[model samples]
Target: MRQTRLRPPRLKAGDGVTVVSPSWRGGEVFPQRAARGAADLTARTGLRVSISSVKPGLCPESRAGRAEEFNRAVQDPATRAILWMIGGLTASELLPLIDYEAFGARPKVLCGYSDATVLHHALYARTGATTFYGPALLSQFAENGGTPELTMDSFAELTMRGWTGRFPTASEVIEEFVDWADDSRPRRAVPALPRKALRPGLAQGPLLAGCVPSALQLLGTPWLPDYRGHVLAFEFTDDNGYGPGQAARDLWQLRHAGLLDGVEGLVLGRPRGWSDAQREQLERIVLDVCHGTAFPIVTEFEFGHTDPVLTLPTGVPVELDNTTLTLLEPSVR
Candidate 1:
């Protein structure tokens, strides 16, 4: 989207990671779980995690305290990477407090998803720094039975070694509804059901995008990076309970804003709650907008709002083969 600027190498065993609460300060209200999540990262990664002071009593409103905590985490020399403690609705408020110039001076991995997308875009746009659209501490690490090994492996490849490759087509797709709190759910072989292609041609570019609404929220903001020559990758959760039409409207807005006008490719992460009819409607909308465009449009990637979510590195080079709808890239570093 902008001039390519890579961050420092991903963390290795013994490297330090910091956990900060940029969104909701659940660590103060829900201290036990938050503490457990920080501890869990050490156990899972065999790396030390430093907890930021701002995590406790993080205010959702625009407060200097929360911003200072996030800035401290970013500016810390010992911190090789920073992970969000949780994602909620109000993370956008902290955008102003982030000194992108300072972040640019010392680029490091900033990782999270959903609400954290705001920070990801802001950092990427202002500094050309690569950010990650991956699982957070509380949702990914602290859950019972610990983090999924696949998820951990993806994190390592993307963050530590920069391993990027086409995600292996899941052998068995699970269409059943499973509870997030259930420890057994992630272990199951939930193969992703394939959807028909919108356009039949391959395209390649840097991968970009996160939760749909979060991306849309930055449409007119200066923080929204240029999408040209980037493959748009997105998915949505049911948290907002948006209907099919509403979802279509968001995509339509992207088209109207010229965000989708000249993208090299498009990867539609599986929309979590769309019915079969709604899915078909989405397919039509995508096809309509991209009718004369010569880029590929692949759907049903097994990332975002899906179990066994594959962590993706934003701003990494990617190749999409429309015939197979397969995504290929070197391991993210």
Candidate 2:
């Protein structure tokens, strides 16, 4: 018998959302900014916001404490959802200590992206609970101006309103950052471009998405989701040492790992600060590495490491065609 994927409860007005720094202590480091995010999220979703405490440092003790906090949220009935403060390199450390049983018992909306990919994949692999790849408290909600309409709309529709249908693209895009200390206005926006097709086709399958390098961390682990028959969506962050060459190697690595085997479709997010030439170069590399594969390949679908992204739900079915992406099921119960 096939197992049914678990869907968390949908959020509603007056419901509570617990904000935890499973990765970095962004809330503690930037109280004002974090508060702004909480306010905006509340205004948009009508969910009460509560910030959970996180221990400082990457020591075993701190990681354990962070996991404990996450577990507390998981087991708390009052916390209808769990939201990450921000993404960072430290999130993978908490995976070993997460109370997967508690999460499975009382699965609620778990949302975040980037480093939180470890948590998303691990929890799903262990329990099949659906989690979201969406805005973070400090990163998206705490934007200099309020969170963009495209970001919030995607988030609220899927998580709170039980919206399911074709995902919309933003009319404008913003990749530049405004200093947190001086966030008195919004980031500059440029005309939005349509998704470019590297390989044209259509398919439908369970959605699996995350930041590229972060997802690679689960390569040989029990936590990584089975990539077969899934609509895989990946995005890259320009931070650290990521460049065209690195992107090319990562794509090849994923392919070699069999992560691309039996995939229904491939969706790539637009990396921040990517020039037209760089985008074309990466596309060429993908074509080379994935040569002879027939799965549909679409690039620049507007998610991850960029302003205005879709709040994608893992473990849910979605449809991907040459021109549009559609969620086949509601993310929450």
Query: Would you list the C-alpha lDDT of every candidate in the order shown?
Result: 0.73, 0.86
1-333: candidate 1 lDDT, tens digit per residue: 564556656688888898887777666666665667678778777778877765456544455777878888788788888888878887787777788888888888778888888888888888887888887877666555566666667776777876655655444433455454443434445445774466767777777868888888887788888899988787776575675677777877888888887898888877765677888887887787666678888787766665455677777777777735333544334
In order, what is each prediction's RMSD in angstroms?
3.1, 2.0
In terms of lDDT, model 1 sits at 0.73
TM-score of each: 0.87, 0.96
Q: What TM-score would candidate 1 get against the native?
A: 0.87
What count of clashes does model 1 give? 12
Candidate 2 error regions (>4 Å): 1-4, 55-61
Q: In model 1, which regions exceed 4 Å deviation?
A: 1-3, 55-61, 171-191, 323-333
Q: For residues 115-174, could you state the per-residue lDDT of candidate 2 as single tens digits?
A: 988899898888888999988999899987799999999999999888989999788899
